[model samples]
Target: MENHNHTALISKLLTCVAACENCATECLKEEDVKMMAGCIALDRDCADICSQAARLLQRNSVIAHQYLLLCEEICRLCAAECSKHQHQHCQDCAKACMECAEACHAHHEPITQD
Candidate 1:
């Protein structure tokens, strides 16, 4: 990836992580938290994966491609799940997830295969 893309992707990844964290936190406080179990789980997973992916990206790791693949899938899933609800946090998270997924997918190509 070019320097610009790398920077943008990292920003998107961090946005995704923050969104996921916020979504999960809000989901836990929902009246029917049990109904959001899956969403919460996905949010946590997506956040963690995006965080790791961002760190790997910063280091220009060859294996970041794998992390991007995983992050894209999880972010998409989390977005879909979040979109199921009308909560503001979930909606925001959905947007962030979609953006992150797009960035990750766009830059899925492997770096130098060290």
Candidate 2:
């Protein structure tokens, strides 16, 4: 069960990283980059944290629960930020962040149990 949860969570985290990266790149291309500064910053932060969470999960870290909780919170914040924009990339990133957060939440119990 833990293996299944880890696998799914890692997949979601990777998806989130990709989405966030793409969103940040798109934000850079916007005419008013300053207006998208917050979104861009959040995208980078979300991607980095999600990547770190995936790595820790891969290692079966004892502190995985704490990392997952942090990842979930960051993902939620990034999603909220992306949701305020109308661009396709932002919209897509928001969807991925939500998915990652949901998967992280699902995997929380097993990590906390042990």
- Residue range 1-114, candidate 1, lDDT tens digits: 333347888999999999999999999999999999999999999999999999998987767776788889999999999999999999999999999999899988644445
What lDDT does each candidate get?
0.91, 0.91
Candidate 1 clash figure, as a count: 0
The TM-score obtained by model 1 is 0.90
User: For residues 4-89, could you state the per-residue lDDT of candidate 2 as single tens digits?
Assistant: 34777788999999999999999999999999999999999999999999998888777776788889999999999999999999
Candidate 2: misplaced stretches above 4 Å? 1-5, 109-114
TM-score of each: 0.90, 0.90
lDDT of 1 at 1: 38
| Candidate 1: pairs in clash | none
RMSD of 1: 2.6
RMSD of each: 2.6, 2.7
* Clash totals in order: 0, 0
